[model samples]
Target: MSQQSNDEQGGQHRRAILQVAGAAAATGLLGANAASGQTARPGGRDDAPLGARLQGVQHFGVTVQNMDRAFAFYTEVLGGTEVMRDGDFKGAPVHYTLMADQEIVARERRVDPRTIGVPDLKGGAQRLDVRFVQFENVVIELLQYRDAAQPTGSGDSWAEPRDHMSPAYPRSMHICFYVRDDVNFDTFIADLEAECARRGMTQVRANRTVAVHSEQERRAAPRETNTIKIHEGPSNGWSIVYCKGPEGEQLEFVQVLGPVKKTFADAAEARRAATNRG
Candidate 1:
């Protein structure tokens, strides 16, 4: 959504959704032009496919039923800092841009998205609340709309979900984070659950922290010559666990024994400089 909208759709004023995302724009998030609501082309070259042209992810969009609850859990429990927040986006540019959708004939049938509007009696983000929380390397975009669809929970209770769509189902997605070297996976899980209890948030559970094997390592390892133990399989000390976030958000944590290599972005920048010189 364009943070500062210059025009109105019908008669509603547009919110500055993009305005608040200046950091993302400067950092090449999603390869999008935040100010203009368009795609961006990097390197002054079309050397890559549209997807490859992307530099990095800006944030994960999460629609939550309770922004306050979600905010507390992420900040207090998960160590995220609120970077930017805006709560008045209903019927604004953000609504049309981020929430609006168009239909394609090849797709399945559904209620027309255009009909879903602000001031919607049933549920919409009439009271649109948006928050950007910054963790070490990733950002979480937490959103809450006024009248939403069936909420993810029943009420003021905290427990593993009684029922949920299996990850096997299409469109199911999860977020993963790298467990810090100073933190033990098992201890992290223990502390995580304990923290939630103290905060009166939903208790979390992590399944296992098994070693990452050869096959998985090959796919996930960085493809650089200065590489270290990543290719050595379980000997690399890589392990992972799956868990549920405070509000049942799917999460994964991994630990890799490593002398962290230069990030791919840094490597790519060097390559770009070399190419430009040549």
Candidate 2:
């Protein structure tokens, strides 16, 4: 075939790929299950309204400037068990394209940086060092990005000792750990405060326990327990405290005194039966 013919065929192929990507990108995750011949089975975890097919909170990640320092803080101070570490995480093709939008990989591959779900990936991260630390039922991921582009779009790029938004800053996030039911709340706070003080942690504040549940909520619990973890703590409620972790990462601890109030599963079951009978 002639060079012109080859070029024309390549253009057609590329156009086709872009068209399919644009269409399927809207329902990409759900389509993955269908693509594998998995449909909504009765009583299955995913059996729900199309847009509401969510199971639960899987995990959350935060980017840190120093991996080892953050690792020690989470593991030693918080008693989190380090489960896994990925020195180099092989992200999707879209990840590289978004990170370096002006690079050859993005330009040559015809990857649109404005793909629906991916808003904008700031800072061209050189290397991704990740560690998974599990605490009770949840896992927290610690990410250390080497030589990241400045969010301000100034001063080339910075490595360790980089800047971050404080806890009060918009979009700044924090992870709150629940104090064990068996442990004394005051003792937990004392140990944590001492550790943070030793490490020179900033912005440490432990607020007095408050009853967050309103009178309306207390009255509704007999009927509403099925949908959520309604009655979590004692009638007096829980206490919350905040501190700055390594690199000023916002940290939170919550303690609910006494055995947590049970969600009336029997009430929910009776409600379901009534609905069926009706």
Which is the leading candidate under lDDT?
A: 1
lDDT of 1 by residue, 1-278 (tens): 45433344322332453544554753345433545676546655466456544555777877665567778878888888878776544454445455444333112345554343324311333445567888877788876655343343222321123366446667878888877777656666666766886777653655432334553452343322112224443344555666767666777776665533234446778867765554
Q: Show the colliding residue pairs in model 2.
A: none
Model 2, residue 191: displacement in angstroms? Answer: 1.3
Residue pairs in collision within model 1: 2-18, 3-16, 3-17, 3-18, 3-19, 123-147, 124-147, 125-145
Candidate 2's residue-wise lDDT over 1-278, tens digit each?
Answer: 67865565455445444533443332232354656878767775456554345423445677666566677778987888876664432233334433554554556767764432222323224434557777775677776645443322112213434366457668878888887668666566656656866876433333333432664443233321211122453433455566556656677776654343222345557756754453
Question: What does the lDDT come to for candidate 1?
Answer: 0.56
Please give the range of 10 consecutive residues that has the lowest summed lDDT in model 1.
152-161
